[model samples]
Target: MSVLNTAEIMEILPHRHPFLLIDTVEELESGVRAVAKKAVSFHEPYFAGHFPGNPVMPGVLIIEALAQTGAVAILSQPEWKGKTAYFAGINHAKFKQKVVPGDVLTLETEIIKVKGPIGIGKATAYVDGKIACIAELTFAIG
Candidate 1:
């Protein structure tokens, strides 16, 4: 089911509960790409204030989830181990669908370019095969 569990993902990425959006990594290709999943639940903290009657998973968090997936891809490299990947930029982001509680997001990020400590990944988040969000994420490792 999971190529890398949450515990294993923690070893590669510096993130924790409430903020760690990804549940499990379904596929990994070292520094090239990664596919992860996140199960959205109404019990999430933000749901309390994100809109009383209507709960919607924020688009920003979806992007962050995508970024985390990309981080896993970049940080998995031996040279980048123990390094933190900071967001340099986010470009061409689009939210096509609303992700709500009970939706399981399938996030994928493919490293498209890398130069020195900076890299760019093409990311996409999907819910039940439908695109929820897409973006080009840039990261700077330090």
Candidate 2:
């Protein structure tokens, strides 16, 4: 069990500013599970047009953040380290609540199965202890 900081996250994930949605990983257990966070802010570029008067974090981006967290869990493994994880598919995605600026989204991912370069996981996004989004994501490591 270990906590990974932004520096460590950058080493594993290829995402950068305006796209690197994960702020910090608070918990990690190799291939088993992981938890991370993304602090939503009004300064985000997307907020500008997402709705000028009433900005809201886009649902797709929320799912992407969750998938990115799952990627961290998969890539953190020694054998998968340095590899890139691509979004293979998403299923059973649902947005239960709206995520807005000032929300600290807690992203949780648990590995459901993994075989070779293919991995499947379940992810959930929470804000203020309430689930905002949930999905079953599949990824392919290359």
Candidate 3:
């Protein structure tokens, strides 16, 4: 189930609906790693313009969800509480499969390195135990 619900996640990360992709945080290790979930629904606004009938969740949003999961890991720390994590860079991003409506997207992000306000995370998104995307994300805490 969810360790942190959408409301609780909002307290740590300054993200709101439509943009706030993660529905719940299943696992979290302060400043180290996090695993979150997003239920892809046909009702999502992006499905309209993204495609008329063949609705597919954008690859960029998948990466953003991964970054948001990483932000939860970083922002949950006492020292970093209330801070915002901004994307500094995204490297080695690979999309392996399409994410569509009714899919349960599982996101995991592990903080691999941190120096001052900058951190790097190894992130992955999976659907039904198969990897959908993977990337190395760099973030700046401010």
TM-score of each: 0.99, 0.97, 0.99
Residue 80 lDDT in candidate 2: 89
Stronger candidate by lDDT (2 vs 3)? 3
Candidate maximizing lDDT: 3
True-structure RMSD, every candidate: 0.5, 1.4, 0.5
* Selected candidate, larger TM-score, 2 vs 3: 3
Off by over 4 Å in 3: none
lDDT: the better of candidates 1 and 2 = 1
Clashes in model 1: which pairs? none
Q: Candidate 2: where are CA atoms >4 Å away?
A: none
Per-residue lDDT of 1-142 in model 2, one digit per residue for the tens? 3388888899999999989999999998888888999999999999999999999999999999998899988888899888999999999999999999999999999989999899899999999999999999999999
Q: What ordering of candidates by lDDT runs from best to worst?
A: 3, 1, 2
Write model 1 residue lDDT over 5-56, tens digit each, in one string.
9999999999999899999999999999999999999999999988889999
Q: Could you tell me which 10 consecutive residues in candidate 3 have the lowest summed lDDT? A: 47-56
User: What C-alpha lDDT does candidate 3 achieve relative to the native structure?
Assistant: 0.97
Task: lDDT for model 1, please.
Answer: 0.96
Candidate 2 lDDT (Cα, whole model)?
0.92
